[model samples]
Target: MRLLQVVLAAVFIIFQVLPAATRAFNFERPCYLRGGICLKQGTPDCEPFRGPCRAFTVCCKVKGLWGRAAAEKP
Candidate 1:
């Protein structure tokens, strides 16, 4: 019974930690662009449309540069 409890505890911890580990990273704020220029208060292009505009590129979190998409809203 004690071993089972320990296993359950480990599983629970893993479940909690896994999500944090897999969390997405945001690279840039959602913005709109036109004619190859970024617009303020605009939307970005991506799979799920969160706002109006579209994303410029696949915004990914870079090491020295910016980060990737943080998370996608359902």
Candidate 2:
């Protein structure tokens, strides 16, 4: 039990110590968007953007419609 507790603590500390920017996923930011399409201070096209959504968006979209990451050829 102590060994399991230690392992869990280590994992938690490692995740907590990661940089904030690395931990967050912003869809509007180009770096996060990568080669994907994003609104450039304007509305994006109604057609779904063909690339990775932000990490948070990924979770939400994944729960519903088929997301780009799932559709991409592996």
Candidate 3:
């Protein structure tokens, strides 16, 4: 009765408010390095190998810094 009503109200409010409050985030992964240089983008040389990963993922190599690809698009 009253409990059911409250639960329904809560669920309704969550459904209405949750999407507006949520935000998109980028995921980061570890990049592999070779001979003082980080591998180029789209290189399948990630150590502890993660295979056939998501399309948004890339091997980031900047100068001598190496890191996993970050979310570039939603």
Could you say which candidate leads in TM-score?
A: 1
At residue 1, candidate 2 shows an lDDT of 100
State the local distance difference test value for candidate 1: 0.40
Alpha carbon deviation, residue 8, candidate 2 (Å): 0.1
Per-model tally of clashing residue pairs: 17, 0, 0
Pairs that clash in candidate 2: none
Span of 10 residues, lowest total lDDT, candidate 1: 33-42
Misplaced by over 4 Å in model 3 are 23-74
Model 2 lDDT tens row, 2-74: 9999999999988887766454544333333334333222222323433454432321112235433322211
lDDT of 1 at 48: 39
Instruction: Summarize candidate 3's per-residue lDDT along 12-39 as a digit string, tens digits.
Output: 9999987765532222334453322222
Measured with C-alpha atoms, the lDDT of residue 24 in candidate 3 is: 24
Candidate 3 Cα deviation (angstroms), residue 29: 16
C-alpha lDDT values of all predictions: 0.40, 0.41, 0.44
lDDT assessment of candidate 2: 0.41
Error of 3 at 48 (Å): 24
